[model samples]
Target: MKDKKKWIIGISACVLLMVSVFFVFNQGKSNEQVVTEYFELLKKKDYKQMYQMLNSKTVYTPTQKYFVEKYKEFYEEIDAKNIQIKILDEQDNVIEYLIYIDTLAGRITYRNKVGVKNEQIQFNKELIMDGYTDGCKIKITTYNPEKRGRILDRNGKVLAEDGKGYSVGLVKGKLNGENDYGQIAQYLETDVETLQKKMSASWINDDSFVPIKTVSEATKNDLINKNILGINGVKISTVSIRTYPYDKVASHIVGYVQNVNAEDLKKHKNEGYNSTSVIGRSGIEAAYEEKLRGITSGKIDLVDKNDKVIKELCHKEVKMSPQDITLTIDIDLQQSLYNEYQNDKSASVALNPKTGEVLALVSTPSYSNNDFVLGLSTDKWNALNNDVNQPLMSRYKQTYTPGSSMKPITAAIGLETKAIDPDKDLVAKDKWQKDSSWGNYYVTTLHAPSPNNLRNAITYSDNVYFARSALNIGKDNLFKYYKNLKIVEKIPFELALNKSQYINKNQKVSDQLIADSGYGQGQILMNPLQLASIYSAFVNNGSIYQPHIVQGQTKTWIKNVFSKETTKTIKEDLINVIVDENGTGHAIYHDHVILAGKTGTAEIKQSQSDTTGTELGWFTIMTTDEKQPILMTTVVEDVKNRGGSGYVVEHTKAPLDLYLSQVSD
Candidate 1:
């Protein structure tokens, strides 16, 4: 009985051992088979089968058709005939394979991962099954799409369009100097060195097919007749490159575009930007980037190893059409203002009095927008960036002491708070003595003998009168009224802005400081935009209108800050600043329209000299005939000849005359 039991145990042990060996052998064979299948599929140009053999769990299933379409579209053009595949790793649940495909077009490679599931491998079946559809064909043709858009003036007048001008771009890195660089450079009127540098710098390493140059006016005729082999790398792309027919006339206001950079890409990545694209970096281009970046559309074709057509994979239609924007700006007025400031370091801002629409914003020392359309050279970019006058900085963002421009705002505030009666007559102490110790500083008047009233005080910009008014009203009330008018604060324009600063009411407002603050001095700084908007409020009754550059219909109206009565009283007071005969801005005044305005000369202290640097300027105005009170401001920084007499009224008159003549007529 003992012998029989021992025999049974021995047999059971042997059976268990045989079963274990068979299981191990099968597992090894299964792994080897999967690795072999992966390589064989790749060797056969069966991408779909290979994809299926990969670990499916880690692979992402494209959630959208767009994502899959992009990958499939690119892979179809790739040649898999020379592809070499190797097994990189094999674990219980993970497998990795390395693929190397070689072709004259380019070397394509990738590491694919496959997840083992129930001992079965899964991959992209459709991709492998498509095989080499293009293997039978030899000729391959590549086609790029056309660029289309319109260029219009403030009033929809076409300036330059794809239909009118021809543009051609060369594949950035594709042009070879050893074979065709010298010939191409000669044909393009550029040197080989220059072309080489441009091509090298512009080519984004990842994608060499993208055209570097945004636009070049080389026609088909130019390319065909020149016998330029480099032309083979060129592709005809139709895009609208807007020119101001009068190039430099409105360059600053119209702004310009340059080839986008890393910084621009980082800032606008979500805005659908790619390298080799143009974006509005400044001026209207920057202000209207969203509206002007037209929708992009393209056709994606699927082809095989021999570049032969496969089934049409997918063709997506982009519907981002260019939008037309009509600005309140008058092109004629903008041009005329540009002409006036052609030779000076000057800036002017003109706004519609009633609606607060910016009609013209001009700055001199401008460059042609066309220069930027073509990428700017290193030297050209340096010249503009390093210029002492800072042509790149729009003066509207520049803040200066408003001088007497703040007088009207102060006066309006005084009347509203009842700090002073408008009709009261007061004698200007021609000389205001701060105290017994400070002695006396003489105040100048329109009439030397010194006649003083609210009208005469504003017309002459009487420091003494405003000084006493500020003292009586106090700084707390001073800032309150100024804040109400949106002075001493930002006006939320549709662009990046530098914040304006004003004295805190809680800070000390001594008699001398109060006197200086009253006449636009001591501690006050304002940008041209702030002054323009504030003056607009003073002119258009008391309602502060938010200034806007974009012209379009909207569902909401900006809130009104002042009552109707306050606006009426301020309008009457502001008119006296221009039309009172003794007014400081009288030089630019006209009765054809009920024009109201003010002039200022802020003193700037220089380190080199005892004499103060002066910013000569004038601001504010309301016109009745145009049914729009125009608020205009002009500033000429560092007038060399004017010592203390820098308050020359003519600087402001130039832009004002240009604006009124165009709009009033």
Candidate 2:
């Protein structure tokens, strides 16, 4: 009986619809006016008035609440408040109206029909809300977000940018059969079972629009060409994907963006973040998130009991666009450095000693930033995390023994303390013994050079000369000089910089241990960046400028840790290290530029008790070009019974050559 009644009501509704069509064709002034009133009510979102004007002759008419919800669902992406409707024609009481919907994606226009009779209106709601079922009426529309900011090098070369992409989603409960699912999978270039599994995890019901996967433009185009986007339950949306054009070239510096996780969503909820938001996870991306993230806006709709959108209450447009960020790094220089030392476990940092502007910093064994942005598979992510080389660790921040590099710092301390004269000969030998009060400790020289004054001491990297100088200057005075240079303190900068370690304040240090510190061994460890900044004082008239990686700006000078005269005297000694044939770094001398550098090799003991251990080669050089001066520190780790500080000088020459060529151009 119930089925029969429903059929009778359906038949009655069809008959009334036919009559309303005929009445609409008569073209009465009252009917035309009613159509105008219905659209006017729609513009004001006055669902109560719009529902009242619908023709009541139909036996299958929906309730007022459901009626409004259906309209809300139909115009989900549109700003109904700004929607403009105009009458195109009214030849037969049938009014053809044009609806203009302003959307973030673009402006959309479509035609809607209205039938009028006796000051009443009737229209097929199904035409506007396709595939809408009677029981489900809630609607949701995603607004377009502004593109993420571009990351550029100092020279305005794009390092990272937003690229066009697509996201595949499923409108739950809309699929008809296996054939429909298979067709969609085929278009996505995936098997039906794989696509089905993804949908199964995200699926809810007919009302849910669950995103299944993100695809490239090629996949989206393939699906579009196959006409699969029109398939029921399948949805496709264009998105802005974070793209790294240079890939892993500056991976550690530029970083990458990824979709917000549940933890981040909860933590950043107050900041207007959602599950769909993309955020910087590390490096420059994390350091300057506020400037890089784009504004997002969308419309909010209210639904009725039958899951229909009753009103589009508000529409918000993005207020701010993404801001472009420029880094001080030179990508060309950075890539050149990376390629030359990619095989070795090493790091190199190049900066303008005068301004403290970093030109390039390279840490080898880097992983691809693109992989992180696109989302890393578990296996790939694990491979990187578990790799022995620790590709993710930024060697720029890591600390290492300065080796004989500390000799320069010790020399400056000695000059300041009046412990050594610049021209005085030290008579360097192969070995020097510590005093009986300091225990049985003897310092050995790499190669003994006769008439070793401050100049030859630095040129030959003589261990005994520095050891004797450290004893003369005293530990208290040496520690004070290191503190004044801020060598062991955390550097002030945007990126994370680890602090160097010094001898424990309370620990008793014998004279021999203090002598070891002078030769760049023992307990002292120096961060590459901090060491570079301190070395800048040698070229910048004894004043250390704050180290920075952003272009077009100069960091403030911390202080003149060494006097101008002291630096001038020390610079001459440093210059001899490159010009003197007996110097360890003399092999790296170039005719186009004057090079002043120091080379040191410190043993990395496996344990405190293991005196025999692997060596770490260290080299710091200043390419003294009047127009563009570059100071760089290169360290080669785990050099076991192999080439010593010489290898460091070899690697340093490549970048110096590249940098000089660029400057010459």
Judged by lDDT, which candidate is best?
2
Which parts of model 1 have CA positions greater than 4 angstroms off? 1-154, 158-193, 196-242, 262-275, 297-319, 436-450, 504-511, 553-566, 606-609, 626-629, 640-665
lDDT of each: 0.61, 0.77
Q: Best candidate, TM-score-wise? A: 2
Query: How does candidate 2 score on lDDT?
Result: 0.77
Runs of candidate 2 with Cα error greater than 4 angstroms are 1-145, 166-197, 201-238, 294-320, 437-440, 606-612
Listed per model in order, the count of residue pairs whose N, CA or C atoms clash below 3 Å is: 17, 6
TM-score of model number 2: 0.70
TM-score to true structure, per model: 0.65, 0.70
For residues 1-665, could you state the per-residue lDDT of candidate 2 as single tens digits? 99999999999999999999989877655665777676677677677777777776641445777766757655543433466668888766678777765544234456767677667676565324323344534344544346678889889999888897777878767777556876666555456777667667743667677666676666578877877767887888877788888776688888888889999966654345677788999888888787787555555444666656765544556676677888888888898888877877788888888888888878877878877765555567889999999998888778998889899989999999999887888887897877566444568876777787888888888889999899899989988988888766778877898888668667788787788898888789998888888888888778987777766668665777899888887787788899988788899988768888888898887653576788888889996665868898888888665678888888777778888888889
Q: Write the per-residue lDDT of candidate 1 for residues 379-399, one digit (tens) a residue.
A: 678999998877666666667
